[model samples]
Target: MIRVVLTDIEGTTSSLSFVHDVLFPYAEEHIGEFIKNGFSDNPEIQEQLEAVAEESGVSANDLDGLIEVLQTWIREDRKETPLKMLQGMLWEQGYQSGAFRGHVYSDAAEALRSWHDRGLRLYVYSSGSVKAQKLIFGHSECGDLTPYFSGYFDTRVGLKRDPESYRNILDQIGVAPDTVLFLSDVEAELEAAETVGMRTALLVREGPLPETSRPVMRDFDEVDALLRKR
Candidate 1:
């Protein structure tokens, strides 16, 4: 009786090439200038900077060092909260300046809408910041799909591989763990969700994983079948 479906974005509901090849490069190209010229004085920006400094036990005044650290985090695709927040801020400027719209697969958009209409509780769980999640769907190619989500979560809560994060999400949604279906391309993420007693499915868009830890499917069509079985 899966009532809630939590989906990952980068490589599950959308394409990995879009995230790695397109979005990441766009952010990398614009980040420096965006940080220098955009609203760094914004309260959210200041808060995240302070958080980064606190986490690293470094001085917030060290702007150059901070920028260097952030750039390194970007290269590694680290799920550091500060890096995610900064990326979201930089992406905001890119979105508003008509630089590029966030990418969403047509299949994803259509399936999400159909699922929502069928009364399934849809949520997003991504390493990307919650703001980034909203920005992606809000400016999606299919157009403003934010309304389809019941909630959004990011690494600010906890690391994706930590079972406690899935526990927290289940608690927040007030649903029985088994009734929540977690969808992600990463096996570890699914492992964490299953640890929290949630149903799990691997989105195998990137090809077969080295180890088949759970039920693997090529696309949402297979996932649709699995959901229908319940």
Candidate 2:
């Protein structure tokens, strides 16, 4: 039986355009100023900046240089932890300002509620920071669907492509790997979850299916049906 459902945010529960067009641009536009106007003085922001400095071999005190590196990472959509953390902080400001509500697909919104009601635990595992995950769901179009989730996982556990990450999630959730179902748009992420003995499903929103052995799901209803059969 599938006791837990681990889902990816972008391309799984939300649209890719929302991330690329909306979220990324907002972060890119505001990040330089956000760092310049003394927000960098916050201890947490300072810590992440230090991390970025260490990774990029730049000096932490060189704020302008660090901001330039961050802008490059944002443009490339790199999955660096510090970049994600900074993005999350910027997104929090966006969400609070009513700039945009997080986009959750209608199908995902409905199915997630149904699954939560059915006594299945739902969790989110995304490359985005855990705070970002909560912010998205907490301000979702579905109206604060954050209550549906049992937990959230971010790169802090490990990269989603690493099998050990899924293993760590299983351990943290206190569920057998076989009893967890992992859903993602990326085949590599699904493969990693499968390698850790978790059941996996691919969310193919469009285009030709990738060359993968995992079952492809067009929507959450299909996933719900599969769970019912199990």
Candidate 3:
């Protein structure tokens, strides 16, 4: 039985354009000012800077160059830990400043709340940083969906396409892999999860399947049905 459901945000429960066109650009526009004003003093920023340097093969002394590199990473939607963290920080300002609220599909919000009520452990596994995950849910259009989740995980745990990551999360949760259902828009991510013995569902939310055949659903309602049948 599926006891836990882990969902991806962008392109899974949310529109990809919302993240790429809205969230990302907002971060890019204000990141320079945010960083220049010593936002790096934030513990999260400091940690991410170190991570970014390691990922970019650059040094801290090259902040300007690193910023440029990060912009490129954002454009490419690279799942670099550092870039994801920085995006979280930039998003924090946006969320707090009332720039833009997190976008969540109404169906997603409804299903998530219902699933939580049913006592199914819900977790998030996004390429987005954990902070970003919290921010999106906490400031979500549905309002503070974070409390509904049992935990949040990001790329820090492992690459989404690497089965080892799913294995690690399963180990951490102390659950039988078959009881854990992982929802994502990417076939590779689902493939990895399945490899680790977890149940997988493709969220075909107004997009093409992830270039591979796998169990697929248009939304959480279908997922709920699948789980019920189990």
Q: Which candidate leads in TM-score?
A: 2
Checking candidate 1 for backbone clashes, the offending pairs are none
> Could you tell me the C-alpha RMSD of candidate 3 in Å?
1.8
Least accurate 10 contiguous residues by lDDT in model 1: 32-41
In model 2, the Cα lDDT at residue 7 comes to 99
Model 1 spans with C-alpha error above 4 angstroms: 38-40, 209-213
- Against the true structure, candidate 1 reaches a TM-score of 0.93
| lDDT tens digits by residue: candidate 3, 1-230 | 88999898988888898898899888788777776676446776767777788878888778787788888888887888888888887898899989988998888888899989998999999999898999988998888888899998899889999999998898888999999989988888888999988988888877455555567899878888988898
lDDT for each residue of candidate 1 in 1-230, tens digit (9 for 90 to 100)? 97899999988887888778877887777666666664355777677777877877678887666666777777888889888988987887777777777788787788788889989999999999998899989987789999999999998678999999998898889999999999998888999899989999988776445657578877777887888899
Cα lDDT tens digits for candidate 2, 173-217: 998998999999998898899998999999988888777677889
RMSD of 1: 1.7
Candidate 2 local lDDT, residue 5: 95
Which model scores highest in lDDT?
2
By TM-score, the candidates rank as 2, 3, 1
Candidate 3, residue 37: lDDT: 76
lDDT of 1 at 31: 68
